[model samples]
Target: MQTVELTVRRTVGRSLVFQTKVLEVDANRDDPTIVVACPEGLDPLEHHFDASIAWTSALGRMEYAVTTRPERRGRGRVWLLTLTGPLTGVQKREYFRADVSIPVVVSWTDGPPAVSASTNGTEPQTHRLAGVVLDLSEGGVLASVSGVPPPVGTQVQSVLRIDDDEIVHAATVVRHVSLAGGTGVALAFADPSLHGDRLRQVAFEAERKRRRGD
Candidate 1:
């Protein structure tokens, strides 16, 4: 009964096709076929067109090709897609990355434990690094901060605002570089399945808006 968020795309020849989300579907079983409830107005013309579905699992990112079955099921908008190949593991770099500048706050997880500041032991004090996200992807982000970044393997938590939504992610420092007046650090999301979809959506929208010159 577990549900998974899926990004489904359909393509024809070399040109890119429509991209949509599998709104309501649980793909936990090992069955060869899966039932997906897609959003309205997503009917493809070809019954057997080639498609690909990508989702994040506990193992990692995975994707596989599928073909749509002409037959429909369920009461509402649903489509039956049959697996055409085995699932393939995807690398973090394969995720779509967007170049953007967003404000971020990085909290060092390995820093000193929070201690009470007041005599009554009510107020706690902790240190945080303020940074700007230079670029973003579903897998990770590159940020520039005022202070020296932690070691490459350091663990940190980041809070950033994407449009009107504020997102917090637990991440690890994958790469660090010293800038002219600041430090640049790359952070990889520890639990991508929790917020990967939201990041992907934001990146995609940003790319679209850029193309439209908005």
Candidate 2:
């Protein structure tokens, strides 16, 4: 265990895991223990009795087993959680994200193939849905859609546009959608290429430059 302070986030959404100040830590001990002020909202001990703590140390980001069965300290909201063992191997992020907003078209087959009377051609009954890409990364795009979001585990073809460049990729809608966030959904890219990566990066940089009055 290292003595350096760590910033931890939930692995899924990269949301802050805690908003409390560290009260005590015994990193030198064989089995370390950490005491932190409980957050104002949810009680960790209620559900997260045993969970993983993702933190970045001097070595890198890593996660370790943590027990939330707190030992109350007097009347204050501070609670102690024991780290059962040493920190596990460092965790490496799979992708870098670029925050931006861009128009995206998601196309998916609704049902069986349909035949066009004018063209006399048979094709999959595809439906096109519009969304705004809230964040772009090599792994996925988090988008805020207009209408009802597709169900989880559904795979769809997406066309992302950054200026004149349009890149198409297959993506899956994640289950953790936020309706309050304008029907937002997380789409994981099945196969991302360098072309799409460059487009997203360039678009993000351009947006940054614009905000700088450049």
Candidate 3:
């Protein structure tokens, strides 16, 4: 079996999955094995094991078979795990990675996302502002706009503005608000990281192309 290096494409919910190139078909040999090494703070599918991870050499792609596992007893969150199977003939490798990067607008009243006495940006930048999703590489998160925004139950919409394009998605507020002052609302993206992921993917592919040119 031939092995190929695969870059980490995307991640979500503490799971990172990259793909390797499928070997060209010449003859049959032992079933190929894959060794997955995720970055810090991520875990591989434990229960499914090989069933949740598989690839096709003849087809030159991979696919994830998954199911949603309800989070907690209250349905506060969810775990979508894929059951890997034999990848016999995979194609149309669009968005090969399952994770998404969404666009968002963040706002603050008491101060910038991060609190500071001045606006010189000397203070740490508040990437995850209430109602704003600054970065998605970390675990998915919620922003509390006002007074911790809404907890348990709140209605929200994610209006993302990217370049000249805009997309909207519905989201539910899931958090625990408090009486403390200065809170921002987090707008959940049904398709979180949609725009962000696309941009990153395009950049990555472009860089690959450039390096190839070089």
The TM-score of predicted model 2 comes to 0.48
Poorest stretch of ten by lDDT in candidate 2: 1-10
For candidate 3, write residues 1-214 as lDDT tens digits.
Answer: 3322233323332233332332233233343333333212223332232224333233334555433222222322222333334444356322222222344644223323554567555443332232433333211233334323434444455555545775455555545433244453434444544454444343333433443352
lDDT of 3: 0.37
lDDT (Cα, tens digit) per residue for candidate 2, span 1-214? 3222222334343322332446778688776777766654545454344455543333444666666545567546555567755777675644434568789988777665687779776676667789998877656788888877777888988888877978788889875467574888788888655354364355445444444445
Ranking by lDDT: 1, 2, 3
Top TM-score model = 1
User: Candidate 2 — which pairs collide?
Assistant: none
Q: lDDT of all the models against the reference?
A: 0.67, 0.62, 0.37
Q: Per-residue alpha-carbon lDDT of model 1 for 74-147, expressed as tens digits? A: 65556666778887867644566667888998887553455567543433334589899888877889999987
Runs of candidate 2 with Cα error greater than 4 angstroms are 1-93, 113-124, 179-181, 194-196, 203-214
List where candidate 1 sits over 4 angstroms from the true fold: 1-31, 39-41, 44-48, 69-72, 90-101, 109-128, 134-139, 177-183, 190-197, 200-214
Q: Check candidate 1 and list the clashing pairs.
A: none
By lDDT, is 2 or 3 better? 2
